[model samples]
Target: MPTRAHGLRSRYRSLVVAAVAALMAVLLSPAGAQGAGSGGARTPLSEPVYSYSGAVRESVWVDTGLDGDGDGRDDRVAADIIRPREPARQGRKIPVIMDASPYYSCCGRGNESQLKTYDSDGRPVGFPLHYDNYFVPRGYAFVAVDLAGTNRSDGCVDVGGRSDVQSAKAVIDWLNGRARAYTTRTGGTRATAGWSNGRTGMIGKSWDGTIANGVAATGVRGLRTIVPISAISSWYDYYFAQGAPLYDGGPDWLSGYVDSPEALGRCAAVQQRLADGAPRTGDWTPLWTGRDYVKDARKVRASVFAVHGMQDLNVRTKHLGQWWDALAEQGVERKIWLSQTGHVDPFDFRRAEWADTLHRWFDHYLLGYDNGIDREPMADIERHPGQWSTDRVWPPRTTRTTALHPGSGTAPGVGALSLRPARPGAAETFTDDPAQSETEWAADLDRTTTAKAGFRTGRLTADLRLSGSSTVTVTATPTTSTAHLSAVLVDLGPDTIRDYGASGEGITTLTDRSCWGASTPGDSACYRDTAARTAAVDRTVISRGWADLGTYASPGKGRPLTPGRPVTLTLDLAATDHVVPAGHRLALIVAGTDRDLIDPPGSTPTLTLDLSRTTARLPLVGGTGAFVRATAGSTAADAVSMAPGARGVTPPHPAPRVPGDGRP
Candidate 1:
C-alpha cells in the first residue's frame, strides 16, 4: 500500500500522459492539421462556397448631411447589395466589395455602358458589370451604391466635392456599425449590417474609381484596399493643367453634365458654388485643394492598386503619375498596371488574365488568404497589344533624366535634337492663331507656312525607350502680354497606332458578343465585341503639354509681358511609356496655341523661341548608353556639320494630330 501523497503524485503523472496523447491525436488527424489556426484551412478563391443562383439581393439607404432635394431632411444614399444566401442564413460573416458610382442609372459603365437592372419589386436584379455574378459564389458580398444626387440617391451632384465623398464614407461607416441607415429617406426602422465581417474593399473605373480614391484618403477604418482604374486623383488636374483650363467651362458644367435625375434648376446653388470655387485663373483654391487626394496621401492607410493607360488623353496620365508618386513617398504598399490603350478597361484589353489577377488580389486582401501575390512583381506594363512585361518596380529603377538640346539644321523652324547645345542662331518665330487646331499644326513638319517649330532626332539605329514624364523649357519673347504655349512629343514612324479619334478612343463596337459571367433575366452575360481602332500614319503624337504664359510666375496672378522681353516658360508633358522603334525618329513640336485642347486668347501673339537655350529633358531607360547606341550613325558631329541656312527635308503626308480636348 502507498501513502496518500505518493498516490496523488502517481495520478497527476497519468493525467499528463493522457493529455499529451490526445493533443498528438489531433495533430496527426488530416482534417485538423491543415493550418495553425482555429479557423481551419483558408478557403481557396477557385472554390465556390455558395450557389450563384441562390444569392440574396436587397437595398437600403444610408443618411448623409446634405439636403440635396431640399425636403427639410438629410439626404440618403441608395445602396443595392447582393451576397451568398448560405452565409446570411447561417449567420456567418462575409467580407464586402463596394463600388460607389454616379453613372449607374445614367451613362452606365464599362465598354458597353451597361446600367443597373431592377426586378418587379424594385430590388436590383442585375448589378452592372460582372462583379456581382462572379463574386457572390466566392463567399463575398457585392454592394453598388448610387452616389448622392445621382439616380435613386437623394442629393445634388457636387462633382467630387464633400458630399460626393461623404456619401460613400457614410456607407462604409454603416457597414462597420459606426453609423445609421434606414429603408427610406425620411424615416424607417434602423437596419444593421450584421451579416458583414466589417472588412471592405472598393474598386471602380473613372468617376466611380475617383470616389474610391477620395474615400481612401480619409483613412477609413474598415476599408482594406482600393483599385482605382483611370481615376482622377485631383479634380483640378482633370479640368486644368498647370494654370491653363483644359476646357472652356469649369466644374459647374461638369456638375450639370453628371447630374441627370435632379433638375438643373434645383441644384443651381451647388452648381454656382462649383463655378465660383473654380476661378478662371486656374489658381489653387480651397475647393480644388479639398478635392485633391494626392495632398492627403499621408492620411491613407489602405493599400492601392492603380491602373491607367499611357495613351489615355481624357483623364490623362499625369493624374496617375502624381498620385502614384505621392503614395510611394508615404511608403504605402502599392501595385500598378500601365497599358497602351486610351481610356480603356483592362477587361476589354486582357480579359482572362485580368479576371484571374483581380480575383487573387481580392482573395488575399479581403479574405485573409496567404496567396503569394504580394511577393510577386509590383507592376505589369503592356508594351503592345496583348504583350505584357512584369517588373519588381514601376518606371524601372534604372531610369535617368537626359536632356536633349536643339542643334543646327537646314530646315526653317526645324533642327536636330542632339546631346550638345549649339551656338545661338536666328530665333524660330510662329504666330499664335486661335482658329488653328493641333491637327493642322502637326500635318507637315517641313511646311513653309506652318505655325509650329519642329525638331527631330535622326533615324534610330536601336530602340530607345522612354519611361516617364518629359519637360520642355523655353526662353522666348512674345508680341502680346498673354500667349498659350503647347508642346507635343511625336513618334515619326510609318506604323499603325492606336486611333483615339474624334468619336472613340481606339475602340469600335461590333455585332458579335463575348461572355464573362453567368446570365440572368435582368442582366445579360454577353456583351458586344470591340476591335482596336488602328491607323496607319507617318507620325503619331505620343504626349502633349500646355501652359498659359500670363500665369507663368504664379497661377493666381497674371502679369503682362513687355513687348520683346524674353521670359522663360517650363511645361511638363504627360507621362508616357513608349518605344521609339529602330529606324524611327522622335520629333518635338513647339507651338503657341493648342485650339483643340484649350480656350485661346482674344488676340494672336507671335512667339520667338531662343533655340540655343531651349531644351527638352526626357526620362529614358538605360541612360546615355541607350541614346548613344540608338543614334550612333547620326552623331553630334553631323549636327554641327550642317550648313547654317540649309532647309530640312520633309516627310510626305504626316499623320493628323487627333483632337483630344473634349470630354469622353
Candidate 2:
C-alpha cells in the first residue's frame, strides 16, 4: 500500500516547526514554554493551534456544521485554511484535500503532543502530528472531522458503513460554503484523501478498506478515488483459506469495535451496543438491499488504485482477484499493485501515494489537472527474487499454462508427464488422530500433523511464478467416520512468507473472518454452519473437495479400520509467490492437519492423512508440457537442477535431509 517505507521518507517536518514556534512563544512570552520559566498563561487554547509549513503565517480554527442527511442532528466539523505567507495567488481557490476517518474524536485535531513532532522536512511524526500543517502549507485547506457517535458529531457508529458516507458529504459541503478560517479567491470544491483507518476513498484493505469499498460503491459524488490496501473483498476468504472456518479472528474484532476507547470508559456498554449474533443493519445488509459488494463490486464508480501483498496471510491476493474481476467488468479506471512486504508496512506507504494519486485524479476530473495518472500501467507486480514489472492489465495478457505431475520417492516415471500436472492415480495416505494435536504448515495450526509429506520440483533454474489455483487430490479413508483436512502452500525458506495471516485455529484477536465464512463468538465457532461434515451411516467414499470445508462426522457405530475403503481429500492450495533458485526446490506438503497454521489442540474434530495415494497437480508455464524433464535427489549435496528453464529442473534450495519439525 505504501509507496515509500515509513520514516525512510520524511513525514514529520511540520512538528519540528511547531516545536520551534512553541519554544519562541515560551521565550517571547512572560514565561518560557515547557515550563522554562514561571508558567506563562497556563490556559490551553479552547481550539487546536494551527500552522502551515513553508509559510510564516498560521490560520486559526473555524467550526461549522451541516445536516448532511437532513436528519436534524447537526454534524459539527472543523477546518484550517493555510495560505502562503508571502503573497496571494490571483483568482484561484486552492484544491482542498482532507481525510474523514473515525479513528478518534475531533479527528485527532485537539492533541498538542501531536503538534510538536514535525521535523525539519515538514512531515509530522509525533502523536499529535496534524495534517493541516502538512497539507495546508502545500496549498491545501485541510479539515478533519469527528465521525458520527464521537465527539460532537451526531448519530451512532455504523460499523456497517453508512454514517461515514453522510459525514463525508457534510464535511465537503461545509468546505465549499462556510469554512470561516480563510477567504478563497477561486471557488469550487476540493479533493479528499486519507490513510489507514481514515475514510478517504473506497480503498480496500482491513476494516477501513471494506468500508471504503462500501462507501465508494454508493457512488457518492465527492468520492473521486479509492485505494483498497490489503482490504478484504470477500470476508469469508479473508478469514478462512481452502474453506477451513476461521473460528477465532471474528470475535476479537467485534470486541474491539464494541469497546473502542472513544466511548469513554464504557467498554462494557460499547460491547453491549450490539448483542452477539445480532444481524447487521443499514446499507451493508445483503438480505435487505440484496446487494453484496463481493457479489457486485462493479457498483463502485470511483477510480480505484488497489494495493495488495503477495504474501498477505489475512487478506490473500485471491481476494484482490475478486476486486480485479469486478473492476474490470465495470471498465472503471483501475490499477493494482502486488508487493512483497507485510500488510501494515505497505499500507502505511500506500496512503501517501493514495493522497498523491487522488490529488491528480481530482485535478483531472474535478479541477482539470492533467497529471497523466491514467497513462500509468494498469498493474504493477513485484515479482519474486526481487524485480518489478508493469502490465497493461492483470492475469497478464501473455500468461502460458503448464502442468506438474506428482510421483512417489522423487523419481521420474515412464510416459508423458505434464509441464505442471498431477501424476494420475498416484496417492498417499496417513492416519490423523485429532487427539495427537500436531503443528501444521506456515502459521495456522488447523493443518496439524498426521504424517507430513511434500514434493518439490528442483530449483527453477528459471524463475517459477504462478498466480492462480494450486490443488492437491488425496484418496483418504478415515479409521474414524470423519476427518478434518487443511492444506497450505508456503514459499519455504526465510524470505518467501509475509506476516499477515492467522497462525492458529484459536480465535485471533486482531481480525474478522465473517466474509470468509469463519466467524467467532466468545472464542467459539460462529460459522459452524459451514464447518465440514459427513454422514455417519456408511463406509463410503466421501470425496470432500478443498477450497471449502472438510468433513467432521462420527466414523460409524464402529471405528472403520477397514483399511481397503478409500476416502478422498481434495485440498485447494492457497496462492503463493516463490522464487525457487537454480538449485532450490518447490515443495508441496500434506498432513492430517497443520497445527501451527490451523485449528488448535482440543478445539475441533481431528483429521487423519493417508499419504500413500496422495497426488498433487502443479501448473507449469513456458513451452509445451513435455519440453522439460525432472529429477530428484536422495541426498542434500546431490540435489537436482535444470539447464536454466530448459526442461526438467531440480529444486535450488536444498532441503535438510533430517526433518527438524515432524510437521512439514
Candidate 3:
C-alpha cells in the first residue's frame, strides 16, 4: 500500500522516539544509583506538609574502614533510615537528621526507654525517640545508626576512641557519596544514599550526643550543626575530675555493657587495650588525648546548639563550661540552655517549648530558612524550677574573679571569710576522715569538728550571684606523702529547690501522656508528662571540687610529698549559677574524701593550712566593691542556724546505677 521510500522513513522515526523515552525513565527513577534526581528542589514551609506514619524505611551498613576488633576485615556500622515517602515518589531529595549511638540496642532512650524494633523484612520498624515521627513529615530523613560494636554492627566499641568517632563519620561520608555502603552485612550488594540532599544535622543526649561532638571535631564537610545534650567534651573528664579518679575500669565496663554478640566474639584485644591505657592512676595518658574533643575545637566548622543540666553530676558541668569557652575562643556559632535539673533532657523538662525551638533550629540550619534564632540571646538559664531567664551570653560581662581570704572564728576549725588578707603566720589544721562526706560536714556547720575546716562570709543585705567555676588555692603541710581534698561552696539558708537526688533526678513522670507528631500502631509519638520534684533545704551546696594532693600542678604526673613539707595545690570546682539571698551567708568547707562521690584515698592524711596563704577565687557577678556593698553593714554575728530546714537535707549525689543508663 506504500512506496519504498515512505515505508523506510516511518520505521526510522519510530526507532528515534523509543530511544528518547528510555533515556528519560533512567534519569528520573527515584531509586536510581545516582542521588538527588535532576528535578526542581522543594522549598520548605514553616509547618509540616508531608506524611510521617507512611514514611519509607530502609537499612544499610556503612564501612568504617577499621578492624577495631581484629576481625581481619573492615568494620561495618548499621544505619536504619526513615524518610518521607512523598519525596521519593516525586523523585526529590530531603535533608538528614542523624543520631549515632551505642544505646540503640542496649539501654534504650527517652523517658519511655524505647529501643529499636525490626519488621519481618529486617527494616527498622519502631525507631527510638521522637525525631523520626516529628521531622519526617517536615521533609527530613532520620537515620538512627547503631554505633560500632553495638547492635547489628561488626566491630568493637573503642569507648570514645578512634573507632567510635569514625564509625559515625563514615555514615556522613556515605551520604555525601564519598564512602561505601552495603545492603547487607555480608557486603556482596552495594547500596547508595539516593534519597539524601547531602546536608546533615546531628542530635542526641548523653553518650549519643558525645559522638556528635567527636564527629564535628573532624571538620567533616556535610555536617551543618550539632545538638549535644548533657554530653562529654573530654572522656578523661568523665573518669577523672582534674587528677582524681571518679571510678576505676570506666571504659571497659561501658564497652561490655553495650556489646552485641558479634562484638563479644572478636573484642578481646580491644578490651585489653582499654585496660592497659587507663591504669587506675589519676595522671593523664595518651589515651585521654585521643578522647579529648576540647583540644580539637579549632577543627570544628559546624555551629553548636548545646544543652546541659546545671547540676548534672554524671557528665558534670565542667564539660560544658570548658567546651563552651573553647568553642567561643574559635568563634564557633553557638547557643546554650542551662537547666536546674540533673542529667535530664529538655524534652522532659520543657516539652512543647523544646520541640518548637528544635524544629525552628533544624529549619534554619538544614533547610536554609531565615529564622531569627541566630539574632536572639545566646543563652537561656533556669534561675529556679519553672523559671527561665535569657542573657546575651553566659557569665555576664560584669563578672570578675574576686579573691577572699580566711580568718579565724570564735570556734575551733571555723573561720570568717573577708576581702582582706589574714595575718602572715595565721594557720588552720584538720585531720582527714575517710568515712566523712559533704552531707556530714554540712550538717555540723555550727558545731566544732576535726573532719573539716569551715569558712563563711557575713549575711548579705542584697542578692549576690556567683556565675561560673571557682578555684581554691591552699598552702598546706600534709602528715602523709599524699592526700585527698573536697571543697564545697554553700548558701547557708532555708530555701525550696529541685530535688535532683530523687529517683527521677529532678522530675516526676505523670500518668497522662502528650503527643508530639504523627503516630502509627507500632510506634507512637506520645510520651508521659513530667513535673518538678521540690524539697525544702536549710543549706544548698552551691559548687564542689575534688583534688589529689599529688597531682596539683599537672594533670599528667603526680608530685609525692615529704610528710611535713609545705605544698600548694589548687582545686578546680564545678561550674554553677546561683544567688545568695539577702538573709543567707556564703560559706566554704574543705574536708577529706567525699564518701560516695569519689573513690577514697588509700590512707587518711592530716593536713595543716596557713590561713594567710589560703584563698578562694570566686566568679562573682561584679567586683569586690559590689560584693561589699551587697553585704554592707552585715557581719559574722548575723550567721544563720546550721540545723536542717522544715524538710530534711536532700540526699547525697546520686550514683549512676540504672542498668541501661549508658553512663561513661
Clashes of each: 5, 107, 0
Give per-residue CA lDDT, model 3, range 1-664, as digits (tens): 4787788888888888787776445333322212221255432334456677778888899999998888689999999999887777777877899999998887898878889999888888899889988888777899998989999998999889999998889999999999999999889899998889888999999988899999999999999999999999999888877666774347877787788877877887888888788767777889989999999999998899999887777888888888888898999999999888888889999888899889878877887765567877888888778888888877788889999888776555458888878899887778888677787887677766888888887788889989877999988888997788888888888877778877677889999999888898878989999998877788888788888888766757777767998888888888888888888998888887887577777667888888899899999998787789777887755658544534434544545434276453
Write model 1 residue lDDT over 26-141, tens digit each, in one string: 33331112223326644344334467677788888998767865768788898999887776665568888999988887677877677887878788887888888777767788
Q: Candidate 1: global Cα-lDDT?
A: 0.76
Rate residue 263 of model 3 by lDDT.
83
The C-alpha RMSD of each candidate to the native structure, in angstroms, is 8.0, 17.2, 8.3
- Total clashes for model 3: 0
Residue 609 in candidate 2, Cα distance off native in Å? 6.9
Worst 10 residues of 3 by lDDT: 29-38
How high is the CA lDDT of each candidate model? 0.76, 0.39, 0.82
TM-scores of the candidates are 0.87, 0.57, 0.91
lDDT score of residue 572 within candidate 2: 54
Model 1 deviation from the true structure expressed as Cα RMSD, one decimal place: 8.0
> Lowest-scoring 10 consecutive residues by lDDT in candidate 1?
653-662
Worst 10 residues of 2 by lDDT: 534-543
Predicted model with the maximum TM-score? 3
Which regions in candidate 1 have their CA more than 4 angstroms from the true location? 1-43, 67-72, 260-265, 410-413, 424-426, 447-449, 635-664
Report the C-alpha lDDT of model 2 over 545-579, residue by residue, as the tens digit.
12222321221111223334565545655443333
